[model samples]
Target: MRNSSPPLEVGIARWIEVMRRNLLLASIVALGVFGIAAVVIAKLPNVYRAETRILVNPQRISDKYVSSTVSMGPAERLNTLSQQILSTSRLEAITTELNLYPKERQALGRDRVIDLMRHHITIDLKQSSDGPSAFTISYTGGSAQEVATVTNRLAASFIDWNLRDREQEAQGTTLFLEKELATSKSELDALEERLRVYKVQHLGQLPNELDANLQTLSRLQVQLQANSDAQNRLDQQALLSRSGSYDASGEQGENPQAGLRSQLVARDVQAHRDLAELHSHYTAAHPDVISKEAEVASLDAQLTQTPASVSSRTRRSGSVASPADAQETSIHHSRDHLAAEQRQIESSINNYQSRVNGVPIREQEISQLLRDYDTAKEHYRSLLEKTYTAQMSMELERGQEGGSFTLLDPAQVPDAPIGPNRPVLYSMFLVASLVAGLLVIALRERLDSTVKSDGELHDILPHIPVLGLIPRISKTIVNRSPAQPTLRRAS
Candidate 1:
């Protein structure tokens, strides 16, 4: 006999049995996937990382020109120097010396090692956020010890570069100034010579005053000539009177007005001045011009009314006027007047020359100014050149600077491996189990089709006496395998 039951419990049992069967299949598939994943993960190569830290401080802070008002700050100088270290040329040197890329890099003749070094390297600057300083260097690499070694090398190189730069900059600057000094001195000397020559050639010469003196001398000379002419005429008249050489009767006679040969002095000067103005303004036939012209003619006639003559010592002692004495006195008077005018002119010329001679001194000052300008320019250029050299040297020194790093913590060998994720393996295994279980369920359902249950049993034998019903147990929940446990099928 079999035990009878409702369909609901049997359905629940079958549902659970199906899930159990699926779970078993899933487990098998999961195991296989997890094993493969584990092997693959283990076969991958491992990479090790290395790092080093360093600090930067000035190695030599000796101030040679502390008194100089203009100088650069240390930080500015250091930073500028640091930037120059990133150049490939410097890296190439280090790489060659360190056997970094390969010894065959020299043989293969490829400078590609420089690029490799740059790629493998990393520099991290650790600046103080709270302080006014930023001079730390950090290098990282795949090789643990190599990173530190390279970092150390960089510091050393930078220091060497800095020293060399300073030395060269100083020497070079000095040389440049020296050359400029030479050129400036030469220019100054030439200017001096020119001034000296000018002074020697134009000694005791004056320009502005000389012209003024010359004009005065000319006027005075004219006056002296007039005076001499008057004196000569007076003497000549006197001589003529003594000899009775000329008279209105065309014979030698004495006349009191003869010695007094002074003409109408300055009388025609106004008329001459008016005539000149009229000549510029109008034609000579103007009315005012004709009246002044007639007046001038009348004055001339009055002045010529008396013939110029001189009286002799007539009958006082019956003295004969000595012609020889008169002639000698006239010559002596002419010589004396001419000599006085010449003396005045010479004195003026000498004064002018004396002033003109001072120009050479002024010229010398100009020459000095030119020399100073040249010297200053030369020094400026020299200093500029030195600045560049110093900057370059500082950069190299910073790069090779040995104190750029500090060993905060050194890496030590570890006893256990850091990783191959074991939990991820377990999760993968679970996922594979679900997939395989579903596949098995679908395949079995397709092959075997059945609809046997409690309701169907009642329908098949309704006339038969229903004695008992039995429940089908799920294979998954049975808790025993055919090979592991004794089993019996329900009947």
Candidate 2:
């Protein structure tokens, strides 16, 4: 039969026997792996991390007093600042100024150096109930002092960029509002000018002047009626005088002076009525009221002068009196003046009637103008208020009293390294070495064909019986002297 090792089985004894046979190989494998791990771990450089905390300080002034135009929250603000401060140009400048990453800059070039710097920098936000109230800037580097310095520099850059960005935003907002306010003012002025021109173009037909136009029309009508009445009386008197049947004693009176006095009194009464009506409608300063007052004064003067003139004429013509022809001529002359006055009044009435007729159209147009004017005025006022608030916000930003970032805890040089944990790494490698050693032993045992135990031989041929076991001798007679030639046999 072909000699071969017994089939392997799941037994502790078999594994123990196999392990003992390959103990030296397993030890060598384990020691080799452990040694390499230790050496590599020991040679690795130490990395130190330095951190700085920056608190997002809220606005010092109350929001009610002056609202900030910059409405970015802390996280968003930090993100924006990170973008600006961590740009290639900015990082390069900082590296050049601080003389960081000298070897990387020399070997990896400018771009690679900036990339490495960004990789080492970390911005961790710290949140609270309110929001992101603070954040920590961490930088890992080979040197302890270098990491600390870089972290502080990054924090400073972040703070400066935040301030500058916010100030620029505020200034821009103020400038924009100012421009808007100027535009609103211009529009307001244009509307005001348009209103003035419109009022001038339609003077007496405005909504406000409707009452005065009606009053003037009524006054003119009254004057026309009074004139007509006087003309009728004069015509009746002329007819009576021409027929030689005129009564000299009546309400008009018997003499020309009395008739003149009566006409003057009637005109005074009508003037007073017009004045009272005007007073009811308008104030004393109104044009219509003033005109009526003037008319009343003129009537008074005429009434006063008529008596003086009548008395003077009576004395001058003590015997020779006013003749019928003279009286009739005076009456005709008065009738002619009344006729002319009536025509003038009629013309004025037509003009005022046209004004009253056009009132609705003018009123509608004026209402639209007023509505637009009011809207524009309100808009201008609102813009003015916003401009003022924007100015105040700008001032607040300039003063650094608005939302800003402050260095809460400055970065300090780390006392110890944080990377390359030696003990833990050593333990991990020790366990891995054991696993590798066991795998090597199992592999060597699986490939070996030598049958070292009778149990394995019996298991391979279970149907056959094992009669005896051989105990091999350690010494051989060939290697010793021939006189000591003895055979060692197994039972």
Candidate 3:
């Protein structure tokens, strides 16, 4: 009896049986597909690839001392170089100059050719433990010589572009720093000028001069006080000289009018001294000045009256003029000089006091100016330093001493084609053909209802009982002669 397993649960033996029944059909399908693949692969054109390796050389000078203005890393630099070199205009120029892709250009136009060339060109970065240390520029083409030339051209373009870009960046940085420095300097100068003008406008009243101003004011005050004391002493001396000379009994010695004249003279000196003191402290239009002037005028009137009275009395009484009269006149002149001196001292005191009082306001103004000036000076100094650095970097780039690309390995004509590796492709196509053959076998088996296996028949009729089996007759025995048909056909 046959096994009753389902047909869908096929084992290795069942799979072998299925494969055997369709082996010829499977072979024809697989071989036919493989033959077509072999023909197509053989007819395909050979593509050549050429590469140029470039090392990303750092600045010759140490970065610690003269850092390059361009701070891009190796990978980023290569990418930027790739974009710039592979730009439409640049590629177009290279294509025209090198006469690259001439057939593609004719067939597909300039734009399409550029796209194809771009696709064919590749830039691959080589990274190390440190970073991307080098990169390769490769171009694929039909001809080895053309690919090598184009690759070398691209490498040259990258190097040249890196140098030119670095220089421009350095120069641009320098120019920007210079402009900022100029602006900062202008601001600093303006602040300085303002400070100078402010100091000049308020010479004695600046913050730094506050202490000196106070000291000066104190000195002037003392001098003024001393001057006033001296004036008082002169006043006493003048009074003493104007008084009449006494006899041995301390009697009035000269004319009787001497006593009245002495009194008038002392009053006049006191009034003049008071007027000078007031004139120092107040302006001409002040009330104190007005009052002092009125008092002085009254004293002058009193002097005129006393002198006239003394003269009349002296003439009427036939009294001799005092011998001390000339001394009295000289003393009066000295008093007048001392009073003028006192007034000058008092004026100086007032001037210095004004300066002292203005210290706080001037100090505030000057402090503001100083703060702004200091800030601007700092900014200008920083900008100056940056500008100097940028200039040095620019010079370094111009000298080709900064970060640059060195062609480590120039592209050369390849002896062998880089693509259409026939053996690998042939193996891959062989796999695809096998898969196609399996698919065809599966489709053919799915559509046919013929039960080739007892397992398949059992799957369709699970409840059926098989009591006996009919053995398959061999084709050789069926084609045998009928003369042997009466004999039992048993092996």
Q: Model 3 TM-score?
A: 0.72
Native-vs-model 2 lDDT? 0.82
TM-score of each: 0.44, 0.72, 0.72
The predicted structure with the larger TM-score, 1 or 3, is 3
Error of 2 at 258 (Å): 29
Q: In candidate 3, what are the lDDT values of residues 116-196, reduced to their tens digit?
A: 999999888888888888988899999888999999989888999999888998999999999888889899999999999
Best-to-worst lDDT order: 2, 3, 1
The numbered model that scores best in lDDT is 2
Which segments of candidate 1 are over 4 A away from where they belong?
A: 1-89, 101-116, 128-132, 162-337, 340-491
Q: Candidate 2: where are CA atoms >4 Å away?
A: 1-22, 95-117, 245-328, 451-491
TM-score of 1: 0.44
Query: Deviation in angstroms for 137 in model 2?
Result: 1.8
* Reference-based lDDT, residue 123, model 1: 53
Per-candidate RMSD, Å: 11.5, 10.1, 7.8
Q: In candidate 3, how many clashes are counted?
A: 0
Model 1 C-alpha lDDT per residue in residues 282-336, reported as the tens digit of each score: 3345688578768767755755685544333333325665454466466557645
